[model samples]
Target: MLVTGCAGFIGFHTARRLLTEGYQVIGYDNLNDYYDQTLKQDRLHLLTTNPSFHFVKGSLENIELLQHLFTTYKPKIVLHLAAQAGVRYSIENPHAYVQSNITGFMHLIECCQLFNVQHLLYASSSSVYGGNDKIPFCTTDRVDQPISVYAATKRSNELFAYTYSHLHHLRATGLRFFTVYGPWGRPDMALYTFANSILKDEPISLYNNGKMERDFTYIDDVVESIYRLMKKGHLQTRNTLHEIHNIGSNSPVQIEYIVQLIERELNKKAHKRYTPIQPGDVKRTYANLQTLIQAIQYQPTTSIEEGVRHFITWYKQYHNILD
Candidate 1:
């Protein structure tokens, strides 16, 4: 199996789980300094100790390196999770999104087609539900109205996957993940950033005057869904190869409420500055998990409080913050 972005938050967990299941994983990551490099390196170090794991450091833009990897590993399954991840980051560096998410994905699909990879599971984002007023965003929703470049790129991935699947008979599955949070979560994510700010006695920025909302799906639930989807992909009929499913908590939480939860867990109060909604930021995101539930019998077990507590616990331990 080949796992791109294996050092990333979700990718790391997915690779670790597969390795634990006795599968040989070829982990690929560029270790970009999007956030803290130490965190990425730490995740990679944990995977490197495993005998079943081999790590490769390179960007998706490197087609030659990608081809070399595909030819060398000849992996039967490819999990494509690497991308220019953040929505706001995409605005500042739109070309990064194009180079990594679009061009890089093209290179990857080419390798998959040439190598005849059995299954290609790629990451999509709930932000693809941009400008969607409907609660509980569903797979059937028309995602033609993306407000951010990152979301646009993700939506393009689904379309490109379907086209490739139809033309080449490639078995491709796209999972549209919603605001994932957990212990080893990304620093840029809402949970981590809010916690960091609150802990440091810094004012946390509240957009939309604290009226925003997000479907905060926990990491375990997201990972479990991926695992089941991979297993289910084998028996699935070819007709369903070009399918997209929403992976989220189903229940949406208000942004202000999430801040309170983080404060409670951290035993601190946050100084917040409420402001209008930022450009490229959506007002709300709620996932309609019927498709996921029907496919994998997925039931999110973690609540916002539980997830926040676990993250703060890990955050304190990671930063060596002692009271």
Candidate 2:
């Protein structure tokens, strides 16, 4: 199995789970300075301890390198998770999104097709349901409108994956992930930023006057869902091979409530500054996980409180904070 972005938060957890299941996992990551390179390195260090894991430090944009790796590994399964992730960052650096999400993803799909990969699983975002006032975003819902470049790129990835699956008979699965958070999460994410700011008695910015809500899925649950789906792979019914599912908690929690939870966990008050919604920001995100549940029996059991507590525990340990 080949796992892209293996040093990332979701990729790391997924790779670790695959290793435990006795799969020979080959990890590919650029280790970019998007957030903190040390965090990526930490994940790589942990994975390298397992004999079944092999690490390759490179970017997906390197088409030659990607093709070489694919040819060398000849992996049966491909998990493509690497991309320029932040919605707001996409506004500042739109070209990065194009280069990585669009161009790099095209190369990856080509490699998957060339290698005759049995199944290809790639990450999409709930942000694809942008400007849709729907409560629980479903796969059947229209996702033609996207607010951010990041969302647009993810939606494009799904389209490309579908095309490849239909034309080349390659089994492809695209996972629309909601706001996933937990230990070893990206520092730029709201939960991690809020936790760090609250710990340091710094002010945390609240966008959209703190009215935004997100389906914050825990890392463990997200990884469990992926692991189960990996085993299931691409279902073969008749001819066409394609599947897409939303992996989320199916419960949207208010942003303010999440801040309050962080405060409670850290035993510190947050200094919040309410502001208007930023560009490329969505009002809310709620995932309709019925398809995932029906297909892979994926039911996220972690509540916001439990997930936050677990994250705080790890944060404290990682930062060497004495309670």
Candidate 3:
């Protein structure tokens, strides 16, 4: 098994899960300074402790390195979770998205084709839905419009994977993840940022006057879905080699409710500053899980309250906060 971006939040958890399942994992990551490098290192450190996990410090942009890794391991399944992630950051660094998400993704698919990988499971984002007023977005919904470069790249990945599946019969699955959060979450995300600001008595920016809703899928649920899908392979799909599904909690919670949950967990009041919604920011995301349930026979089950509490506990321990 080859897991790209193994140092990242989702990638780390996914790699750990695979290692625990007794799979020898080839973990690849660039360890970029997109967030805190220390956090990435800490995640990598835990994975490296397992004898089944082999870490490779490299970027997907380097086709030669990817080709070398593919030739060496000849991984049967490629779990592609690597990308220049962040919606707002893509605006400031559009070229980075082009290089990493677009160019890097192309290199990856080419290698997967040449290496004859059995299955390629890659991460997509709900951002591909754009600012649609539609509730409970479905897989069949039109995704011709993407607000951010990050989203466009993700949608492009789906298209590219579809092309490969059609042309070369490369079995691939694209998981369109909703707002995934929980323990060891990204610092740039609302949950982590809000908790940190509240702890420091700093004001947390409330975009769109905090009038937003999100399908906050838990990390564990996301991993479980990926594992099941990977293990099941193309058994469920009778006709096509390419498939796409929305992995989400199927429950949209208001932004205010999330803050309240965090405040309750931390026993602190948040300082809020209402602000206009940032560019590429969506008003809401709700997943229609009918398709995912049919495929995996399951959906994300972690409730917002429980997920928030778990995250707070991990956050406190990680930051050495005593209270």
Candidate 4:
């Protein structure tokens, strides 16, 4: 099993779960200071303690390195989760998206073809839904339009997966993840940032004046969904060689509600500042889980309250912040 971005939020959890389930996992991550490399290193630490885990520190941008890893390991299942992730950051550095998401993804998939990798499970984003006002975004909906460069690059990944699946018969599954949050999450995410700032008496930026809503999927649910899909793809006959599904909480919550939850968990009143919605950001993102439900019988069970509390607990402990 090859898990790219193993130091990242989703990838870390996914790799850990797979390792616990008795799989020899190859964990690859650039350990970029996108947020804090210490957090990434810590996540990698947990996995490295296991004898079956092998860690590689490198970027997906290096095609030769990716090709060499693919050839050497020849991973049967490549979980491509590494990417320059951030909607706001994409606005500032469009070239980074093109390099990491577009160019890096192409090299990764080409290596998959060369290695004859059986199943390719890569990460897509709910942001691909773009500016559609439709409630609970559906996988069947057309995604020709993208509001952000980050989203555009993810959509491109799906297209690449489809082409690869069609041409090479590589079983590819592109998971469109909704707003995922939990322990060990990226610091830039709303939940973490809000909690961190609130705990430190720093003002929290409420975008769209706290009107934005998101389907905040928990990390455990996401990992379980990924594990099930990977196992099924590995075991089952090639009935569906090319497929896409939305991995989300399946429950939409307002931005204010999440803030309230975090504030309550930390027992601190947030210093909130209302702000205009940033470009390349959607006002709302809700997932239609009918497709995911039917495919894997998967349903996200974590509530906002429980997820928030769990995250707060971990955050305080990780940072050694006493209430």
Best by lDDT: 3
lDDT-sorted candidate list, best first? 3, 2, 1, 4
Which run of 10 residues does model 3 get worst, by summed lDDT? 231-240
Per-residue lDDT over 1-323 for candidate 2, one digit per residue giving the tens place of the 0 to 100 score:
99999999999999999999899999999999999899899989999999999998888889999999988889999999999999999999999999999999999999999889999999999999998997889999999999999999999999999999888888988999999999999999998999999988899999999999899999999998888787787555535378889999989999999999999999999999999999989888898888899888768999999999999999999999999
Pick by lDDT: 2 or 4, better one: 2
lDDT of each: 0.92, 0.92, 0.93, 0.90
Lowest lDDT 10-residue stretch of candidate 2:
231-240
Off by over 4 Å in 3: 234-238
Clashing pairs in 3: none
Q: Estimate the lDDT of model 1.
A: 0.92
For each candidate in turn, the TM-score is: 0.98, 0.98, 0.99, 0.98
Off by over 4 Å in 2: none
Candidate 3 structure, TM-score to reference: 0.99
Model 4 root mean square deviation, Cα atoms: 1.1
Error of 2 at 311 (Å): 0.2
Error of 1 at 123 (Å): 0.4
Which lDDT value does model 3 have at 313? 96
Measured on C-alpha atoms, candidate 4 has an lDDT of 0.90
